[model samples]
Target: MGQEREQRPVGVRRRTLLLGAAAGAGALALGTDALATRAEAAPTFIRGADVSWLPQMEAQGYYWNNSSGVRQDLFTILKGYGVTAVSLRTWVNPSSDPANGHCGIEETARLAQRARDAGMQVLIGFHFGDTWNSVGVQNPPAAWTGMTYSRMLDAMYDYVYHSCNVIKYYGVTPAWVKIGNETNSGICRPIGGVGHPDQMTGLLNAAYDMSKQVFPNTPVLVHLAQPQNLTSIQNFLNAYGGNGGKWDITGLSSYAQGGNVPGVLANMQTIQSSYGKPVMQVEYGGPVGKATQVRNSLRAFTTGLQGFGGLGTFFWEPEGYPSFNGYNSSAWDETSRRPTAALDGFLNV
Candidate 1:
């Protein structure tokens, strides 16, 4: 889930609010002033990055330095590049891969604090499984195997609630929360997979309900990869909603290298028009040299979804991690160890 790409021949990877109220007289004047101030304030456009590999990278003694030659952390470098938000993914138990086991709740919370301190909004992605959950893999956690469907649903709710509480304990609330990563086939597996639409919807609702209980104000996103597969996306959402699945936002993953930007833009428009939910390009990346093209694609996506509650875009690991598959096209620039034009796309947007 952290690595949003599919394994290929050294290539390929795909991946608000307001208030009101008032009293009388002097209180009314104060309320009016506050409202006026809020109305006058410019709206925020989210430029985000998913640094789910940061903890492990730092644990391995990797360090990111600023352009000034001063040593800095990943979050600091991201902020300097005009990234306004950071997304982190969490696993139920990453002990299966100890070296990459830094995605537990505590580690994610620590990273979330860093992003928050850097003045960037935080997004929490729950892969649900103990490891990767994508189109090719959506296995349940080792601990969740053999459980009855009912029990699995209960466990989902409990896990989400507990994980969210831990993040809140760290004094960092996520601006957005993804119930599952690249869940085109559905979350968990067998019991929660697309084959069992009812069970899938039940499991999703369980997680979504619990997430809202913990962070009522945060928007919950239902993420799916391969934005070009509009039919699959439409079917999934149809089944989800038909079976009572609910989501506050529609999340997408697209890669310019895959040549799906046009389809992705069309899908975003369809989601907004059909579902009336905000659309977010939660994950996107391509070859560093085509940064300008990627940037234009994102700009078009944002512009299309803007009026229909579009939130903006997030690049998935623009600063690629060698431990992961090490796709050359994904990272900003390997030599400089700093952001390249690929990341500048977001800044420019």
Candidate 2:
């Protein structure tokens, strides 16, 4: 009941470099501040590297099948792949303290350390749940189960503070953060969800206020589900005064790329324009199943997203399959063992 609609960000990106044509040559190597500022003054482009789910996998030594050799250091692997940052999702405390949860602040901090060791910026995804969290579902960490509204808000605050402080404690403040992932239904739904403009605005205001207070230097992004919801996203953010109006960068979750990378890229341009903010594809790209396929899609994806209000992107979870076991078994990868074509897209430019 927050709003019965969907939205997407917008901008039209020509294959040709719009502003910094000469500078926007290979990949991020040439994507310096001067180029970004120049593009922004007129129109900017997104140059990013997706290092989300690789570190832990490499460390644990599952199939991994990356291009650098199955045994190579993943960080070295990441830097060579042209990845400037790594994204990881935090499950609060997933498994019962007794159940032995998977990802925790401590685990994420360790991963962040590896990414930092490779000179990569870290994008910590605070999933806001004690377990696997997503848009259709936004459960609090189990510890906060059955809490009152007043306590719930405090719970959220603690979650934010704990996540940020833990990362900061190790001195790896993320480049950008999403309060919730694909909040197509709005965050903290049902309990303190906003069904009216006034209420939604207050809800967003509170979340944004906490984000700004905690991570002022690092931008906070509010994410929408997909391109189809671009407008509703804009409307909600504008009404709520979050990203569309003030949040630093507009973030998106594009599941379309799997079917048509170009279409997905085109949609990103459109959404970026609509949102009127630097764009970040917080979630996109996934296991292509074949190295050759990865190469083809990644190149087109790289070309399409360049020079048209393209800020950056995190390829969702390039290799998150292993952690999921048989349930998301497809998520696990085969052992091609050298930086996969997906890795090469950012690596070779």
Candidate 3:
């Protein structure tokens, strides 16, 4: 889901702009290019886009243009901008809501197949809910709502196994698999909340085990937003680690603004060094009007994280334009119906 999601707690709502005070400390210590030369020797760095909105957008009469004003497929446009991968999110028995629905396994599988056909690596994100799931909310799927804790573990395993098999049946084996989306407070709440770390870890381990069962070679990620908040992340990592939470990659959502990219990258590097897990910026973007700023930030993140031996950076719902879903952090231009310069940041990294 896009960052414009609703029903956030009072203090946890997504912040669009970086506070001046917040941008001064670590950023000054680690400039954007501090690690640029080191990143030159890193392995294949993925610059991806979350086109979960692509099918719906196309159905609603939306298309994209190349830099020369020539109409072309969205994938072609993204490729021209140096995108090497695509991330798709899936829900469990999703509703028919136009903007916020219909990412069920079948739909996601179709998208994965298309991404594979385009020669881009695929990263599958499982929300494990019937609708949007984020740090703000993580309601269990309708079918698993009243299940007992033990029963919920079974359901989680079954769901992951079934979903993975179904997706693979569509002829797309994802390069990376995200167990959940922005699962900071924990997944499925109440039962999976941090208050009951063991329960949450139980569910997470089930998902991780099932994911490995299907895609043994794929890296599984545990995601959280707001990488700059050291206290929050350290607490979650402690709770997760204390309870034996399993993950191959530590995925993050970086919406860093002002000059906080350095601090954010520092925090990510810290996570990697401390946890022995590679990191990736799984979600990021900014308003289309801030195209140049967003481009620079993206470049910094991609290059900086690459230097840190991180996996990748993906723009969340970059295909989303105004009126499509009430989201504004898109990489596409509204009036021109073409990609903004924000995506150009992915190049030459």
For every candidate in turn, the CA RMSD to the true structure comes to 10.5, 11.8, 12.0
Per-prediction TM-score to the true structure, in the order listed: 0.82, 0.73, 0.87
Model 2, residue 34: displacement in angstroms? 15
Expressed as tens digits, the lDDT of each residue in 156-209 for candidate 3 is: 877887788777788889988998898888888778887888999989977876
Model 1 lDDT on a 0 to 1 scale: 0.72
> Tens-digit lDDT track for model 2 on 33-109?
34334434644233344444454444555544445355555555555556666677777766533113456777777
Model 1 residue 122 CA deviation (Å) reads 0.8
Candidate numbers, best lDDT first, in rank order: 3, 1, 2
Best of the two (1, 2) by lDDT: 1
Best by TM-score: 3
Candidates in order have lDDT scores of 0.72, 0.56, 0.82
Backbone clashes in model 1, listed as residue pairs = 15-253, 15-254
User: Where does the lowest 10-residue lDDT sum fall in candidate 3?
Assistant: 9-18
Candidate 2's C-alpha runs over 4 A off are 1-70, 96-101, 192-204, 242-246, 321-324, 327-333, 347-349
Error of model 3, residue 213, in angstroms:
0.9
Query: Candidate 1 has what TM-score?
Result: 0.82
